[model samples]
Target: MQTITLDALIPREDFNILSSTGSSSNTRNKQTLSIEDLKYDSFFFSALRKPIFQRETNEWDAEKVCSMIESFVNDELVPAIILWRNQGGYIFVIDGAHRLSSLGAWINDDYGDGPISISFYGNYISDEQRKAAEKTRQLVNQKIGSFKEIEAISRNRISTENDLKNDIAKNLGALAIQLQWVDGNAAKAEDSFLKINQSATKISEAELELIKNREHSYAIAARAIVRAGKGYKYWSAYSITEQEHIVELSKKIHQLMFGIGNINMDDINSLPIGGPLNSSLTLDVVTQTVRICNGLDRKTKTNVGDANEVITYLRNTLRILQYINSKEKFSLGVHPFVYFYSGIGKHKIGSYYGFLMFAKELIEKKKIDNFIQVRSRFESVIYQYNFLVQQIIRKDRQSKRAYVSIKDYYVLLMEIILENPTYSNEAIVEEIKKNDKFKYLQTEIVDNETVAVKSNFSRGKKQQIKMETFVESLPRCPICGGYICSNSVSVDHIQRKQDGGTNAVENGQITHLYCNTTYKN
Candidate 1:
């Protein structure tokens, strides 16, 4: 990973713009700065820090960042860049890390989508993020032009190309941004960051919680995993050997979740575990890890009170996910049910949490073997009844019931698997209706109309139809229980035909031909 000095990243302007000349104490009272001040004031730029709790750079898209620049050029109601003064004369960004970073990115040409962000965050950006950045770069370029292009124009204005310079002067040159400084000490600064960010931030509550818990092993591991070891080194304080372990395990999980795209960007063909590559899934994965390993109740908040325990939990969580994704061990067919699936259709966080809870139950209750034994049959049901399965997942997912609702459904899934019966869609729906927790969800409507709208059931049915093409596109295999690469599958008699078994539906089973002849025979 490359570490860059602030000076190396900072761009210099042609004119020498110094900090306000006054008594040091008196100058400290000024709480505002213009774009020119940000550009010229060495101390102002030098003292800026994107707080630890601040979001990753990629959280804001290029267009959003560019909008801020556009707003600056347009001189609109741009918000103040909140700052906190340190013990010396240093400054820390409290509530405007994204705004500040965007300006810095524009100045430094390090829009979290490119090699600059990769290098800045120690070379850990995902392909998804790089693509996003590339798009941002295009948008920024198309909308506002690159910094170099504008700078060149700015430079040439003093020479013969005065017309071009004058045309862009307002858009590129003559604008100022307001800065607001927080009063009090470092604690107050942190408090201000939290309070101000509560309303201004785009980060979710769970993600903020993870940022707040950064010191914990799970948080560090999650940060490492989410960025695919491309972001800031949260585990830097550990011993080199421990750091290696963290890196190795995090890489293993990262690859399992995201593939080796960070290492070999070109080979990335399939979507990652978190569809569309939402970094917030890292928080969910971390939370589930801690909750499962510690055997904590689902309703309780997962915390960082125990670092060692958290590390162990993450390891266990990685192990389970690895097993689920493994080709050899417990090949779960169509296991995307475990993660959020927002491709052509809608899937929810409940799908992600539900899988975690299911895995936890399997691990804790020593039901792995039972799950494996019935896995083939269970997967058949899930494959055939994909619509109802998603409907059940969606019904419970409303009002943020992912963490709780998944467990209820997982229990139902286990029961269905254990019973070894042909579960019709109606039967499944009936069972879901009987579920005390799902009763209210059974007859719910999910629209924002003034009066009662169509039921969520109707919506899910339509969604289910939309999803049919996708589901049919998936390779169906009952033996190995995943997408089949083989051109043909063998249907064999459960009771051998030689034993006078009738050709009944109950007597037929699907299996890989290799399994039917080579193994079963």
Candidate 2:
């Protein structure tokens, strides 16, 4: 990802131009400034944030400024303020982040003494130096402090020392608290913040997802589900984005079906198991969970208990492992599983599994890139797997002893993964050739036998034995239970009249040709 240019990202310049005398020269003087102009200093704040400041931002204490700005940003009663320009585009505060975001609950009453009665707590300081700094702040705030230089910045933004309160509520629109430092400057600030602020930690995407939880109740519910569960973190999942994708998938499915504004906790029970969570193969577990939790006999009204959570989590985990460790030919390694499972609902289950496995093997064996191969192979396998699955489903529906040829297995043999993933004709024959049943059923071409046996790399074209006809029935004719179906079942040319069959019961009596000829002699 390339950095967005500052000029490109934030364009409209409607702020007072900086005069040479270190003051804002109000340029828009066509008419007297309205109360709207003074009501909130949007232009003034904008002027305070000119990009010129970002040029030499590193020379200043960015951490201290960012921290102070964070404070002003948090306080609600405080109006939009800026760290205004000096000469040129030297910038400062744009607006109160806290106040603009609506962080104040209420202003103090007039009868509550001259000072505003507000509830506020200072930083989570944990050192003597910080304590002394707090002491300095108190001294300045009480007008008896040594560090009076920051008195202007420290005047409680809201009034009772509270012009603004910085908690969770503030007029975010009026306060629109955006730090207008340059991208490069922001990077510098970030680097400095990391170096100087030893205790301050940056927000991670996981924590960010948690913080932004309220924005999307669907995500909130998914995060809550993961949080509520124990002994399982999404660390094993493909990626954080993939984990988020699962939540989004469920949210999308619900939105698509019911047009629900958000995912309902009760209705979420209907989600496809692992359908939302698994990063590879099928979301069988997700579907199953939704099925079990929402199915008629289930009881979602009683909050999904601990048992269900563990069962569901483990079920999905094991299913994913199964999807990974499937088929002797290939393994769907960690990386590709994440990539392929994103839009797998549109592909055939077996094909998805096979393609993932093939891609993983391809990455390791062929030394290919996982990202590109995943997408490219995914497209390739869709139609092939789709056809393979269609053939399987069709056979399954027909309820016949589905006969598949070994010649046909290569198409779907990327891997024989999943719970009974239907095999193609060639795959079935290969599987049967590997089978110990009817040892004579194989063609031992390489081994110099009539029938051959399968090799290690059956999926790849290596020298091999191929299975001929399906010899699923018993050795003897199942009906008569007397003669071997293998040889006794000779083609008794139906046109017996054409041959000089003596018109006698003995000649007419049907039997194995070998049995009949010897008996006549």
Candidates in order have lDDT scores of 0.55, 0.28
Clashes of 1: 2
Which 10-residue window of candidate 2 scores lowest in summed lDDT? Answer: 105-114
Per-residue C-alpha lDDT of model 2 across residues 1-521, encoded as one tens digit per residue: 10101111111221333445443342322222121222222553223232211111111121332333344435422232323333345343332222221111011111101121111111111122233233323432343212222233335444223443222223322334332321223334333323322343333332332232222322223332321221122222335554444444444333321221121222222222123221211123222223322221122232323323423433333333322322211222221212222222222333333333333344346532232222223333332233433444344434321212211232233333221245444454455346443223433234344666674544312211111011122232121222222212322322355666556654444333322222122
Residue 449, model 2: lDDT of: 48
Off by over 4 Å in 1: 1-43, 158-165, 169-174, 260-269, 278-290, 297-307, 327-334, 337-343, 380-401, 428-467, 478-521
How far does residue 186 in candidate 1 sit from its true spot (Å)? Answer: 1.5
Q: How accurate is candidate 1 locally (lDDT)?
A: 0.55
Each model's Cα RMSD: 8.6, 26.3
> Which is the leading candidate under TM-score?
1
Model 1 clashing residue pairs (backbone) = 113-133, 124-230
Model 1 Cα lDDT, one tens digit per residue, 1-521: 11112211322111112244322242445556655545423556765556655554445555577797667655677787777655555566676666666676666666654445555556566555556556666776777667667776667654324444345554555666777778776667777777787776555766676666666655666666655544456666667776667667667666666553332211112434443344434455545544554455435665553435535755876766654453333333234532345323433555655666677677678676566555555555445544444566666545655555666665676576567456664565466667676565343334566786566657655655655554455554444454432223566687888899889999887654444554455
